[model samples]
Target: MATTASTTAPVSLASVTLEVADPEAAAVFHRAFGVDAYVGLRAAEDAPADGFRGFTLALTVSGPATVDGFVGAAVDAGATVLKPATKSMWGYGGVVRAPDGTIWKIATSAKKDTGPATREIDEFVLLLGVEDVKATKQFYVERGMAVAKSFGGKYAEFAPGTGSVKLALYKRRGLAKDLGVADDGTGAHRIVLGGTGASFTDPDGFVWEGEK
Candidate 1:
């Protein structure tokens, strides 16, 4: 028999969630997810803000020029470029930060995937850095996403539910050490849309926006 993920899970992300103190203001800065869930705001008492350390949202457009346009739009929206748009083995791409401070990566394939003429985000990936992949994986499991693939305690990938962006969990220190950075990510998850109802918080403090 073919296997399937659990359906009893309550949290179902409509799109990616982004918690903001002022949803109206935030609405102007970032645009990626099919849905953007919010908790309250970046300054909510329980969740404090900090430099983006743990997770990143990737937007893979269709081509190089399109990549450049997206990067430019980010900068116009108050993003600080971490890297300029350029062609490489990973195709043409660049990195930038939304005004709200979320790290955004825009890229395309190196070869034929330069993208079609229309240029649009064809793929999306959400990477969450956690203290323990197994534990975090279980947390999200309890929420909704199914474990599409995993690597012991090192990494775990969750299949996308109704949304296009796939979720993945990785060890905080492992990834930080790999990037030569310290694991200083805080609970102030500016966005955390997944699940079915009102906003909620996971064990690691990642927030999830619920259905209205």
Candidate 2:
């Protein structure tokens, strides 16, 4: 007789929910920022969270113009500009802290605009800043996630797998430095990830709940 092996379904990020004190206000800001479609808002306790929130939501666009456009819209929507849109060795991008305390990064790989900037997002990524990248990466892998890219202990990106938001892991301190913020934070992450299959908390305290 042949024995059968058990297999588990791969875990994918289905939705991202930002727990905000005022969902209505957060929705308005997200709408103005042009990312309302990518995130969900829910009412949460107005917990005291200082410094970086241990994560960032990044929007990848087409060109520099689009990057600037998104950043401008975010600022106009009452977000504080952490980093102005500028061309760097890797790309052109900027960082903004939403009115609800979520940090957002809008960036583009293309240095120049080939056409007019449109309200289009190429990719929505949730980068979790963890204390141990390798350990967390292994945790996700053991839970049936396939690694899309890995840079040793520094960074790790997982396959999106039909999910709306791509997931990645980065060192907490390094991620905060990249976003131009201090790495000292307390209280809840104030974000929830909707995942397919069983729910589990990651090593870094990021919560993932199975979608209903």
In order, what lDDT does every prediction score? 0.65, 0.89
lDDT of 1 at 26: 65
Positional deviation of 92 in candidate 2, in angstroms?
Answer: 0.3
In model 1, how large is the Cα lDDT of residue 162? 74
TM-score of each: 0.71, 0.94
lDDT of 1: 0.65
Query: Candidate 2 residues 36-80, lDDT tens each?
Result: 999999998766666778999999999998998999899999999
Model 2 off-target regions past 4 Å? 1-7
Best by lDDT: 2
